[model samples]
Target: MMGGPSENPELWAFLESLHCGEFLSGTVTAIERFGVFVALDDGPDHPVFPGVGFISFAELSWQRFEAASDVVQVGQRVSCEFLQFDTWNLEARLSLRATQPDPFQVFADGAAVGQKLHGRVTKLAPFGAFVQVVDGIEGLVHLRELAWTPVETPSDAVQVGDEVTVVVTEIDRERRRLALSRRKGSSEHR
Candidate 1:
Protein backbone atom coordinates (compact mmCIF):
# COMPACT_ATOMS: atom_id res chain seq x y z
CA MET A 1 0.00 0.00 0.00
CA MET A 2 2.90 2.37 0.50
CA GLY A 3 5.39 1.25 -2.16
CA GLY A 4 5.59 1.31 -5.92
CA PRO A 5 3.81 -0.85 -8.56
CA SER A 6 5.95 -3.87 -7.69
CA GLU A 7 4.52 -3.88 -4.19
CA ASN A 8 0.94 -3.99 -5.50
CA PRO A 9 0.66 -6.00 -8.67
CA GLU A 10 -3.14 -6.07 -8.62
CA LEU A 11 -3.36 -2.29 -8.31
CA TRP A 12 -0.71 -1.82 -10.95
CA ALA A 13 -2.71 -3.94 -13.36
CA PHE A 14 -5.93 -2.11 -12.63
CA LEU A 15 -4.36 1.30 -12.97
CA GLU A 16 -2.68 0.36 -16.22
CA SER A 17 -5.95 -0.88 -17.71
CA LEU A 18 -7.94 2.27 -16.91
CA HIS A 19 -9.00 4.53 -19.80
CA CYS A 20 -10.36 8.05 -20.00
CA GLY A 21 -14.12 8.44 -19.50
CA GLU A 22 -14.46 5.22 -17.50
CA PHE A 23 -16.67 5.60 -14.45
CA LEU A 24 -15.20 4.21 -11.24
CA SER A 25 -16.28 4.04 -7.63
CA GLY A 26 -13.99 5.15 -4.86
CA THR A 27 -13.99 6.20 -1.24
CA VAL A 28 -12.53 9.52 -0.22
CA THR A 29 -9.19 8.66 1.30
CA ALA A 30 -7.76 12.07 2.02
CA ILE A 31 -8.75 15.68 1.61
CA GLU A 32 -6.14 18.29 0.86
CA ARG A 33 -6.32 22.00 0.23
CA PHE A 34 -5.77 21.38 -3.45
CA GLY A 35 -7.73 18.20 -4.12
CA VAL A 36 -9.23 15.00 -2.81
CA PHE A 37 -7.65 11.54 -2.91
CA VAL A 38 -9.85 8.52 -3.51
CA ALA A 39 -9.03 4.90 -2.80
CA LEU A 40 -10.62 3.31 -5.80
CA ASP A 41 -12.81 0.37 -4.80
CA ASP A 42 -11.98 -1.43 -8.04
CA GLY A 43 -8.24 -0.76 -7.95
CA PRO A 44 -5.28 -1.63 -5.82
CA ASP A 45 -2.98 0.47 -3.68
CA HIS A 46 -1.24 3.28 -5.52
CA PRO A 47 2.51 3.19 -5.65
CA VAL A 48 2.83 6.68 -4.16
CA PHE A 49 -0.64 7.93 -3.19
CA PRO A 50 -2.95 6.81 -0.39
CA GLY A 51 -5.49 6.17 -3.14
CA VAL A 52 -5.33 5.43 -6.85
CA GLY A 53 -7.74 8.21 -7.75
CA PHE A 54 -7.44 12.00 -7.47
CA ILE A 55 -9.89 14.80 -8.15
CA SER A 56 -8.64 18.34 -8.58
CA PHE A 57 -10.45 21.31 -7.06
CA ALA A 58 -12.25 22.18 -10.28
CA GLU A 59 -13.44 18.62 -10.78
CA LEU A 60 -14.90 18.26 -7.30
CA SER A 61 -18.24 19.93 -8.00
CA TRP A 62 -20.20 22.16 -10.33
CA GLN A 63 -20.95 24.58 -7.53
CA ARG A 64 -18.05 26.68 -6.36
CA PHE A 65 -16.90 26.25 -2.80
CA GLU A 66 -14.39 27.90 -0.53
CA ALA A 67 -12.62 24.57 -0.07
CA ALA A 68 -12.56 21.00 -1.37
CA SER A 69 -13.75 19.66 1.98
CA ASP A 70 -16.95 21.65 1.51
CA VAL A 71 -17.87 19.29 -1.31
CA VAL A 72 -16.44 15.96 -0.16
CA GLN A 73 -15.42 14.59 3.18
CA VAL A 74 -13.12 11.70 3.97
CA GLY A 75 -14.77 8.24 3.91
CA GLN A 76 -17.56 9.47 1.62
CA ARG A 77 -18.32 7.17 -1.30
CA VAL A 78 -18.15 8.78 -4.70
CA SER A 79 -18.48 7.73 -8.31
CA CYS A 80 -16.29 9.69 -10.70
CA GLU A 81 -15.70 9.89 -14.41
CA PHE A 82 -12.14 8.98 -15.17
CA LEU A 83 -10.62 11.97 -16.91
CA GLN A 84 -7.23 10.49 -17.61
CA PHE A 85 -4.31 8.61 -16.16
CA ASP A 86 -2.10 11.35 -14.83
CA THR A 87 1.24 9.85 -15.72
CA TRP A 88 3.12 12.75 -14.28
CA ASN A 89 1.56 12.24 -10.85
CA LEU A 90 1.18 8.49 -11.33
CA GLU A 91 -2.47 8.83 -10.27
CA ALA A 92 -5.82 8.50 -11.99
CA ARG A 93 -7.31 11.92 -12.77
CA LEU A 94 -10.99 11.81 -11.89
CA SER A 95 -13.94 14.20 -12.06
CA LEU A 96 -16.71 13.81 -9.48
CA ARG A 97 -18.72 16.69 -10.96
CA ALA A 98 -18.99 14.92 -14.29
CA THR A 99 -21.24 12.33 -12.73
CA GLN A 100 -23.59 15.11 -11.55
CA PRO A 101 -25.99 17.23 -13.55
CA ASP A 102 -24.59 20.51 -14.90
CA PRO A 103 -26.16 23.55 -13.29
CA PHE A 104 -25.58 25.56 -16.44
CA GLN A 105 -27.91 23.29 -18.42
CA VAL A 106 -30.72 23.91 -15.98
CA PHE A 107 -30.13 27.65 -15.94
CA ALA A 108 -30.10 27.82 -19.72
CA ASP A 109 -33.37 25.94 -20.00
CA GLY A 110 -35.27 28.62 -18.09
CA ALA A 111 -33.23 31.70 -19.07
CA ALA A 112 -33.93 33.73 -22.18
CA VAL A 113 -32.38 36.65 -23.99
CA GLY A 114 -33.41 40.11 -22.72
CA GLN A 115 -34.22 38.68 -19.30
CA LYS A 116 -32.93 41.05 -16.65
CA LEU A 117 -31.24 39.52 -13.64
CA HIS A 118 -29.32 40.80 -10.69
CA GLY A 119 -26.01 39.10 -9.89
CA ARG A 120 -22.79 39.69 -8.07
CA VAL A 121 -19.53 40.10 -9.90
CA THR A 122 -17.45 37.07 -9.01
CA LYS A 123 -14.30 37.94 -10.95
CA LEU A 124 -12.85 40.59 -13.17
CA ALA A 125 -10.59 40.30 -16.19
CA PRO A 126 -9.24 42.84 -18.60
CA PHE A 127 -11.75 41.71 -21.20
CA GLY A 128 -14.80 41.25 -19.00
CA ALA A 129 -16.34 40.45 -15.67
CA PHE A 130 -17.77 37.07 -14.69
CA VAL A 131 -21.09 37.56 -12.92
CA GLN A 132 -22.65 34.83 -10.83
CA VAL A 133 -26.20 34.98 -12.08
CA VAL A 134 -27.24 32.06 -9.92
CA ASP A 135 -25.70 29.32 -7.86
CA GLY A 136 -23.03 27.65 -10.03
CA ILE A 137 -24.02 29.80 -12.99
CA GLU A 138 -21.84 32.63 -14.31
CA GLY A 139 -22.17 34.80 -17.37
CA LEU A 140 -19.61 37.03 -18.99
CA VAL A 141 -20.20 40.74 -19.24
CA HIS A 142 -17.84 41.71 -22.03
CA LEU A 143 -15.96 44.98 -21.72
CA ARG A 144 -17.94 46.38 -24.61
CA GLU A 145 -21.17 45.40 -22.90
CA LEU A 146 -20.17 46.84 -19.55
CA ALA A 147 -21.52 50.22 -20.52
CA TRP A 148 -22.64 52.34 -23.46
CA THR A 149 -19.45 54.37 -23.34
CA PRO A 150 -16.13 52.97 -24.51
CA VAL A 151 -14.40 51.08 -21.72
CA GLU A 152 -10.73 50.29 -21.47
CA THR A 153 -11.12 47.49 -18.91
CA PRO A 154 -13.78 45.61 -17.04
CA SER A 155 -12.80 47.28 -13.78
CA ASP A 156 -13.73 50.61 -15.33
CA ALA A 157 -17.34 49.54 -15.05
CA VAL A 158 -17.44 46.89 -12.36
CA GLN A 159 -15.32 45.29 -9.65
CA VAL A 160 -15.33 41.97 -7.91
CA GLY A 161 -18.26 41.55 -5.47
CA ASP A 162 -20.26 44.35 -7.04
CA GLU A 163 -23.92 43.46 -7.42
CA VAL A 164 -25.15 44.62 -10.78
CA THR A 165 -28.26 44.20 -12.91
CA VAL A 166 -27.67 42.82 -16.37
CA VAL A 167 -29.61 41.68 -19.41
CA VAL A 168 -28.95 38.37 -21.03
CA THR A 169 -27.74 38.94 -24.56
CA GLU A 170 -26.86 35.53 -25.85
CA ILE A 171 -26.98 31.99 -24.60
CA ASP A 172 -24.99 29.30 -26.37
CA ARG A 173 -26.37 26.15 -24.80
CA GLU A 174 -24.00 23.80 -26.60
CA ARG A 175 -21.00 25.80 -25.41
CA ARG A 176 -22.58 26.61 -22.04
CA ARG A 177 -21.92 30.33 -22.50
CA LEU A 178 -24.07 33.24 -21.51
CA ALA A 179 -23.26 36.69 -22.80
CA LEU A 180 -24.65 39.51 -20.71
CA SER A 181 -24.79 43.28 -21.00
CA ARG A 182 -25.19 46.16 -18.59
CA ARG A 183 -26.00 48.57 -21.36
CA LYS A 184 -29.60 48.47 -22.56
CA GLY A 185 -29.12 48.57 -26.35
CA SER A 186 -25.92 46.52 -26.19
CA SER A 187 -27.80 43.30 -25.51
CA GLU A 188 -28.66 40.99 -28.43
CA HIS A 189 -32.35 40.77 -27.58
CA ARG A 190 -34.35 38.51 -29.91
Candidate 2:
Protein backbone atom coordinates (compact mmCIF):
# COMPACT_ATOMS: atom_id res chain seq x y z
CA MET A 1 0.00 0.00 0.00
CA MET A 2 1.90 3.01 -1.29
CA GLY A 3 0.54 6.17 0.28
CA GLY A 4 1.00 9.22 -1.89
CA PRO A 5 1.43 12.82 -0.81
CA SER A 6 -2.29 13.50 -1.35
CA GLU A 7 -3.42 10.27 0.36
CA ASN A 8 -1.19 10.91 3.37
CA PRO A 9 -0.21 14.55 3.12
CA GLU A 10 2.08 14.21 6.15
CA LEU A 11 4.53 12.09 4.10
CA TRP A 12 5.32 14.98 1.78
CA ALA A 13 5.92 17.41 4.63
CA PHE A 14 8.37 15.07 6.38
CA LEU A 15 11.94 15.14 5.07
CA GLU A 16 12.37 11.40 5.67
CA SER A 17 9.80 8.60 5.45
CA LEU A 18 9.27 5.42 7.38
CA HIS A 19 8.42 1.96 6.07
CA CYS A 20 7.20 -1.14 7.80
CA GLY A 21 7.14 -4.90 7.17
CA GLU A 22 3.89 -5.87 5.54
CA PHE A 23 2.89 -9.30 4.25
CA LEU A 24 3.25 -8.50 0.57
CA SER A 25 2.77 -11.26 -2.02
CA GLY A 26 5.40 -11.68 -4.75
CA THR A 27 6.44 -13.68 -7.78
CA VAL A 28 9.64 -15.63 -8.26
CA THR A 29 11.66 -13.76 -10.86
CA ALA A 30 14.89 -15.74 -10.76
CA ILE A 31 16.45 -18.80 -9.19
CA GLU A 32 20.08 -19.58 -8.35
CA ARG A 33 22.23 -22.09 -6.49
CA PHE A 34 22.30 -20.05 -3.31
CA GLY A 35 18.82 -18.53 -3.10
CA VAL A 36 15.78 -17.44 -5.14
CA PHE A 37 14.76 -13.90 -6.22
CA VAL A 38 11.22 -12.67 -5.70
CA ALA A 39 9.79 -9.46 -7.18
CA LEU A 40 7.56 -7.69 -4.72
CA ASP A 41 3.97 -7.59 -5.97
CA ASP A 42 3.33 -4.24 -4.29
CA GLY A 43 6.44 -2.11 -4.45
CA PRO A 44 8.36 0.40 -6.51
CA ASP A 45 8.79 -1.40 -9.85
CA HIS A 46 8.79 -4.80 -8.13
CA PRO A 47 12.53 -4.90 -7.52
CA VAL A 48 13.86 -8.43 -7.94
CA PHE A 49 16.49 -9.64 -5.52
CA PRO A 50 17.79 -12.59 -3.58
CA GLY A 51 17.74 -12.93 0.26
CA VAL A 52 13.96 -12.73 0.47
CA GLY A 53 14.27 -16.15 2.07
CA PHE A 54 16.30 -19.31 1.89
CA ILE A 55 15.03 -22.91 1.71
CA SER A 56 17.84 -25.19 2.64
CA PHE A 57 18.03 -28.62 1.04
CA ALA A 58 17.18 -30.29 4.31
CA GLU A 59 14.17 -28.06 4.83
CA LEU A 60 12.99 -28.33 1.21
CA SER A 61 10.48 -31.17 1.37
CA TRP A 62 9.82 -34.75 2.26
CA GLN A 63 10.76 -36.20 -1.13
CA ARG A 64 14.34 -36.78 -2.23
CA PHE A 65 15.83 -35.23 -5.35
CA GLU A 66 19.19 -34.99 -7.05
CA ALA A 67 19.15 -31.22 -7.69
CA ALA A 68 17.14 -28.05 -7.21
CA SER A 69 16.27 -27.68 -10.87
CA ASP A 70 14.00 -30.65 -10.50
CA VAL A 71 11.56 -28.54 -8.48
CA VAL A 72 11.26 -25.06 -10.10
CA GLN A 73 11.46 -23.32 -13.44
CA VAL A 74 12.70 -19.95 -14.72
CA GLY A 75 9.33 -18.17 -14.61
CA GLN A 76 6.83 -18.75 -11.78
CA ARG A 77 4.87 -16.79 -9.18
CA VAL A 78 5.43 -17.38 -5.49
CA SER A 79 3.59 -15.93 -2.51
CA CYS A 80 5.48 -15.33 0.71
CA GLU A 81 4.55 -13.99 4.11
CA PHE A 82 6.86 -11.07 4.85
CA LEU A 83 9.11 -11.65 7.81
CA GLN A 84 10.68 -8.20 7.87
CA PHE A 85 12.01 -5.39 5.74
CA ASP A 86 15.73 -4.82 5.47
CA THR A 87 16.28 -1.09 5.88
CA TRP A 88 19.77 -1.11 4.41
CA ASN A 89 18.91 -3.20 1.35
CA LEU A 90 15.31 -2.03 1.04
CA GLU A 91 14.24 -5.65 0.52
CA ALA A 92 11.73 -7.79 2.31
CA ARG A 93 12.62 -11.10 3.89
CA LEU A 94 9.95 -13.74 3.34
CA SER A 95 9.14 -17.38 4.03
CA LEU A 96 8.09 -19.52 1.08
CA ARG A 97 6.82 -22.27 3.31
CA ALA A 98 4.36 -21.78 6.13
CA THR A 99 6.61 -22.01 9.14
CA GLN A 100 4.73 -19.85 11.59
CA PRO A 101 1.71 -22.17 11.66
CA ASP A 102 2.44 -24.73 14.30
CA PRO A 103 1.81 -28.34 13.24
CA PHE A 104 -0.20 -29.24 16.31
CA GLN A 105 -2.28 -26.13 16.01
CA VAL A 106 -3.06 -26.81 12.35
CA PHE A 107 -4.07 -30.36 13.17
CA ALA A 108 -6.41 -29.10 15.85
CA ASP A 109 -7.80 -26.40 13.59
CA GLY A 110 -8.50 -28.99 10.85
CA ALA A 111 -7.84 -26.85 7.81
CA ALA A 112 -10.39 -27.49 5.07
CA VAL A 113 -9.89 -28.44 1.44
CA GLY A 114 -9.63 -25.98 -1.47
CA GLN A 115 -7.79 -23.53 0.76
CA LYS A 116 -5.39 -21.50 -1.31
CA LEU A 117 -1.85 -21.47 0.03
CA HIS A 118 1.66 -20.17 -0.55
CA GLY A 119 4.52 -22.63 -0.86
CA ARG A 120 8.07 -23.24 -2.06
CA VAL A 121 9.46 -25.97 -4.32
CA THR A 122 11.70 -28.22 -2.30
CA LYS A 123 12.21 -31.19 -4.61
CA LEU A 124 10.95 -32.69 -7.85
CA ALA A 125 10.09 -36.17 -9.07
CA PRO A 126 8.84 -37.77 -12.25
CA PHE A 127 5.33 -38.15 -10.90
CA GLY A 128 5.07 -34.70 -9.32
CA ALA A 129 6.76 -32.05 -7.20
CA PHE A 130 6.93 -31.84 -3.43
CA VAL A 131 6.14 -28.67 -1.53
CA GLN A 132 6.10 -27.69 2.07
CA VAL A 133 2.41 -26.95 2.72
CA VAL A 134 2.99 -25.95 6.30
CA ASP A 135 5.74 -26.36 8.88
CA GLY A 136 5.06 -30.06 9.12
CA ILE A 137 2.67 -30.85 6.29
CA GLU A 138 4.07 -31.36 2.80
CA GLY A 139 2.06 -31.61 -0.43
CA LEU A 140 2.46 -32.70 -4.04
CA VAL A 141 1.88 -31.08 -7.43
CA HIS A 142 1.24 -33.55 -10.21
CA LEU A 143 3.11 -32.92 -13.45
CA ARG A 144 -0.13 -32.00 -15.20
CA GLU A 145 -0.85 -28.98 -13.03
CA LEU A 146 2.77 -27.83 -13.12
CA ALA A 147 2.35 -26.87 -16.74
CA TRP A 148 -0.07 -26.98 -19.66
CA THR A 149 1.98 -29.41 -21.73
CA PRO A 150 2.98 -32.85 -20.61
CA VAL A 151 6.03 -32.29 -18.46
CA GLU A 152 8.28 -35.09 -19.72
CA THR A 153 10.60 -34.21 -16.90
CA PRO A 154 9.72 -32.10 -13.89
CA SER A 155 13.21 -30.53 -13.83
CA ASP A 156 12.48 -28.74 -17.09
CA ALA A 157 9.74 -26.74 -15.33
CA VAL A 158 10.94 -26.36 -11.75
CA GLN A 159 13.92 -26.63 -9.44
CA VAL A 160 14.39 -27.51 -5.83
CA GLY A 161 13.51 -24.83 -3.27
CA ASP A 162 11.72 -22.53 -5.70
CA GLU A 163 8.92 -20.25 -4.52
CA VAL A 164 5.48 -20.86 -6.03
CA THR A 165 1.79 -20.08 -5.56
CA VAL A 166 -0.54 -23.05 -5.36
CA VAL A 167 -4.18 -23.83 -4.55
CA VAL A 168 -5.45 -26.88 -2.79
CA THR A 169 -7.08 -29.20 -5.31
CA GLU A 170 -7.85 -32.08 -3.02
CA ILE A 171 -7.41 -33.05 0.63
CA ASP A 172 -7.56 -36.65 1.82
CA ARG A 173 -7.35 -37.02 5.55
CA GLU A 174 -7.09 -40.79 5.63
CA ARG A 175 -4.39 -41.28 3.02
CA ARG A 176 -2.76 -37.87 3.45
CA ARG A 177 -3.10 -36.86 -0.18
CA LEU A 178 -2.66 -33.09 -0.63
CA ALA A 179 -2.82 -31.93 -4.24
CA LEU A 180 -2.13 -28.34 -5.29
CA SER A 181 -1.99 -26.31 -8.51
CA ARG A 182 -0.69 -22.99 -9.77
CA ARG A 183 -3.18 -20.24 -10.43
CA LYS A 184 -4.25 -19.98 -14.08
CA GLY A 185 -2.64 -17.46 -16.43
CA SER A 186 -0.03 -16.01 -14.07
CA SER A 187 2.08 -13.08 -15.27
CA GLU A 188 5.28 -14.26 -13.65
CA HIS A 189 4.77 -17.78 -15.01
CA ARG A 190 5.69 -18.26 -18.61
Which candidate has the top score in lDDT?
Answer: 1
Candidate 2, residues 15-102, lDDT tens digits: the string is: 1232333345556666677655666555443223443333444433334456655654555665555555444344455555443443
Per-residue CA lDDT of model 1 for 8-118, tens digit only, reads: 667656778998888999899999877899998878777677788999998998887898878989999999999987655668899999999899998988999999999
Error of 2 at 7 (Å): 86
* Stretches of model 2 off by over 4 angstroms after superposition: 1-110, 183-190
Q: Would you list the C-alpha lDDT of every candidate in the order shown?
A: 0.87, 0.58
Off by over 4 Å in 1: 1-8, 87-90, 151-163, 173-175, 185-190
Pairs of residues clashing in candidate 2: 68-159, 68-160, 69-159, 71-158, 71-159, 72-158, 72-159, 73-158, 121-161
Structural similarity to truth (TM-score) of each candidate: 0.77, 0.41
Clashes of 1: 0
